[model samples]
Target: MHAALTFLLLFLMAGTIVPVNRHFRQTPGGIPVFVVSNGVHTDVVVPLREPQTGTDWLEQLQQPQLTARFGSYGYVGFGWGSEQFYLASYGGNFPKPGTVLRALLPGPTLMHVDFYQQAPRPGKRVVALQISRAQYQQLTQLIRASFRPDSTGATVLRNAAGYTPEDFFFRGRGRYHALRTCNDWTNATLRKAGLRAALKAPLAGSVLHQVRRSRFHAAAQ
Candidate 1:
């Protein structure tokens, strides 16, 4: 009985201690960005181009090899997660319990990039926010830093097959575990961009909760 009570308390604490909305100042001349989700996972989507290509940080994705595959998309979505779990779950094979355990423990990770011709339609699983150019640049840096670059200063592509033609996996930095999950990475990226986010979001719900709260606040203002 004591152990059961302790577990219940811990679970409650875990669910609530991470602030779903933290106050942050948006950039004075911010641009629109989107946070998208698919029930279980979340992604950060940024514009694929700008008026001036010279300063477009996402131009790397337009390289011949990638462009030939992803074609022309006005936005790109980025996600990072456990390699085995991601591949298994996305490749039409549900991840085994053992695979999930491995990811929740400690293991390698991957970065998944998906292209979209238009911003995802707003829904319960999607939200958009406005941020300054400086904030956007900071977010881009956070994403680039997450990639494991090869000797040629390019993100190292994973040899494994992707689940879709519009998306591909690349080697990622750091390890994934129950405490530091893909949602945590997304939350951290939002914080780095000076936006409201869960302080330590380990689940997709927590991240999305904060995003929705931010949107509500923006609308109220």
Candidate 2:
């Protein structure tokens, strides 16, 4: 009982301190991008096609298999997490204690991609960010690099039955653990894109809070 209580205290403390520090900066010549959350998970959304660059990269990469899946609006969202944990949790089967424990250790990760027919709306759970075109390109590269591509340079797809048809999972680059979690991936990607984020956000709440703070600060300026 004492050990269980100690662990509970540690978990609570982790939420408060894992992120450690927060910072915000405005990227010059930035374009509009989005940070979206679904209470527990967060995703970064970017354009699927850029008229200025004449690049239909998503269409080119996905080709015949997934090209038809996306709609005219042209946007996609990317997220990363423990494969088992994400599949089980999102499929409505909450992870068992053993599953959670396994995920807390190093484990395989998956990258989730969702196609949106239109730009996602900003609400309580979503915030728009303006970052330079170069930053957006950097963010895209970060996401693409997270996937473990196959011999043909295509991302390996996994079967995630209950998730939306428009979304797919790809084998990811690193292991997922308590310290390097899904939200941490999001925070790291934002930082790679030259955006402001918490130093290390293990929880979606910490990431969303930092994004919201930056959005609010930008608005005030």
Candidate 3:
């Protein structure tokens, strides 16, 4: 009987261990969506998977498939990794190079909340970025303002704020990459503020091409 009990315990332990480890190693294809007015009024949505380009994943989720059944005022972005892991003081240990997480835009109400890391992946590699309703408007405005008549340099313009010409796009473990010119800037800024080690690196000149803007005609108009 004692031997039997020991074997059961061992089996249970192994069962728990495998899942916990698997979640940590799995690459995040997308992120959890939330519409929270504060810590109190919180509505949680399941992780949204990346959809094919031109498909509006956000609107589809907002309808009823999302458990929370909440409405969003904007779309927010961030990174992810294991929850309890410690992130490097600087931007070291982000993820394997070249992975990118892409979420289709719905409207503006969705805000970027904290990135969730499920389990054992080390170094808190997953990251999150949150924005208030006002911030979301400002971001969309910036994107529109910086948008050129041609799409040729739009990517650079989206990422140019506070970055030198050399700032190129990189990804974390969960396939998260910056979409616009300021996305990288915003991520780097958040990392600098949240993690001690995320250093500001020089941007390559070509990278700057997308970011340079003359002015927002909307302002003058």
Candidate 4:
């Protein structure tokens, strides 16, 4: 009961925004990044390469399996969440009560990665943001550290299939619970990159509201 009450309070707090963030200006031709949500969970979408620094994100992470299959992919979406709940929810199936209870406590987590053929259009549930070169470096560093590396310093892949054929699961650092969740991780990544984000993003709406501008002027084709 305590946990349930605490969760409810946090959810309410998360829904109430203190202040909105000043959206970034794309006039400088900064690298394009995205904060995408399914109206529930959030993900940080980054290009495979840092065009300015020539940093190959896939190579730095050494995602061999992912690289082998999606070498030509344009962008990748990274999300962190509770393993059981994420696995159950990824397929659009409702997680069991036991899984929900377990997730409320600190538990094992997973990195959910999705590759994109083209950049996602900025619309509802997708907020487009641009970060400077230095910010991109910080973003990569933050995300790279999230992957649980092995003795050889390579990220360990989970022995499980993903909801999509191309996406895959990987061991992620940190524990996930009701207080700190997938949305929190997304907000943290954005904050670390010096981008606009909520101070405490316990829900997808929390983070999305931070980066979303009142008007979205889609780029010219």
Candidate 5:
């Protein structure tokens, strides 16, 4: 089963006063950019301020992994805090008419996956995750789908109506088109489908999990 990893907005403004550098990374294009890390070096470049750039990036993930990760679909989003990310896992079987798809993310860390029968529009499926195999699959698919034949070539998948680089990755800092920010896509989509907030408020004490604890702790001192 291949799963597509997606995210939902927990914070209306991503309320982190942290330095922009801490949240952003440099791209091969020599551009300083914000990104959504998949717990791997490969990141989804987010053009929070640039529509042309953002759209180009979003289009790239549409081809393969975005559709193949997990089983049929998966999603990624913030967990209980800013430090925790999540994903949901599932198989690739479309249900009978009106039979909505459902999946779960493992662990008791206040995280889970919610499957939407129609997303971005009716008859479309969208997966939202806070922590689970879906995140893993989404990240893996992003990595797998990366690598254009050349710099001029588009990222493997960039034309699917459902794949929005800005939304799939991280929301940009400003509004673009109808989306006030990439986060809006997440919030609107999940909220439209009536999803409860998947993330608790950002932890004041810096909630770092094992993989990030050492690095996060080191920076605190």
Candidate 6:
């Protein structure tokens, strides 16, 4: 089991919808952002660069080794969670007994950032949204703020390699606990960015359902 995929926690899975900003028109011209999920986990994926603004994230994202290995990546997916679960999520195994128990308590957090080669497609496990330039900046700012600062007051990317060369872990802000889960962080990011998100999303199912329902509603309109 990959952690919480099978856990029987009694957290709230129901969530309410927050309408997208009235000023934030859902037009094709808006930047395309994607929320991807792996049933148990969710990631907020964003563009690597905005040609119009000439905003290059490589400098701020710590120039991941992926650039050296494969030139450059098109998109980046940011995830925050317990360091124990993240480190133990190597190969196919999830956290063991001790790891799981410790994760229940307030522990250090890490950002599991992954670089994508192509644009993420919106499917059953992916919800795509078109947001304004301002919204995109806001979303990115929240994500950036989650990174823990190093001694030099900069976001520190761990020297340790990731599951793949394309992804790496960074110290994260805030503590990971039973109440503020990975999915909860994801939900908070969206809500902070002034997007349509659930009222409560401590579980992946809760966040996924809210996003899917919002997408359906938008499509039906």
For all predicted structures, in order, the TM-scores are 0.84, 0.82, 0.20, 0.86, 0.19, 0.84
- Top TM-score: which candidate number? 4
lDDT of each: 0.76, 0.75, 0.25, 0.80, 0.25, 0.77
Clashing residue pairs in candidate 4 (N, C-alpha, C atoms within 3 angstroms): none
Model 5 weakest 10-residue run by lDDT: 206-215
lDDT of 3 by residue, 18-110 (tens): 221111111133232222222111212223332322323234323232223223322322322221121211143433332212221211111
Worst 10 residues of 6 by lDDT: 16-25
Instruction: Using lDDT as the measure, name the better of candidate 1 and candidate 3.
Output: 1
Per-residue lDDT of candidate 1, residues 89-201 (tens digit): 86577899988888888889999888788888878888888676777778888888898888888777785357777777888999988877898889888877777887667
The prediction achieving the highest lDDT against the true structure is 4
What lDDT tens digits, residue by residue, belong to model 2 across residues 1-221? 99988986577446534443245455544566788888777899888886644546565456456765564657888899998888777655678988889999999988888888888888888888776667677877888899888889877777543377778787888999877888889988987776777666777777777676663345545
- Cα displacement (Å) at residue 218, model 3: 37
Compose the digit string of candidate 4's lDDT tens values, residues 1-221. Answer: 99989987876585537533445434346788899999888999999776787877678757566678788889988999998888777676889999889998999888888889889899989988766788788888898889888888888878446887867788999999877888989988887776777768888898888777423334621
- When 2 and 6 are scored with lDDT, the better candidate is 6
Tell me how candidate 3 scores on lDDT. Answer: 0.25
Q: List where candidate 3 sits over 4 angstroms from the true fold.
A: 1-123, 151-184, 187-221
Ranking of candidates on lDDT, top first = 4, 6, 1, 2, 3, 5
CA lDDT, candidate 3, residue 132: 32
Model 1, position 13: C-alpha lDDT score: 51
Off by over 4 Å in 2: 1-29, 53-57, 160-162, 215-221
Write one digit per residue (lDDT tens) for candidate 5, span 1-221.
12322222324124322222232111222222112222321122222122322322224333344434323322233212110121221122334332211112221111111222222221112221222233323333333232333355543222222222322322112222211222322322222222222222122221111112111123333
Model 1 superposed RMSD (Cα): 3.3
Clashes of 4: 0
Per-residue error at 105 for model 2, in Å? 0.9
Task: Using lDDT as the measure, name the better of candidate 4 and candidate 6.
Answer: 4
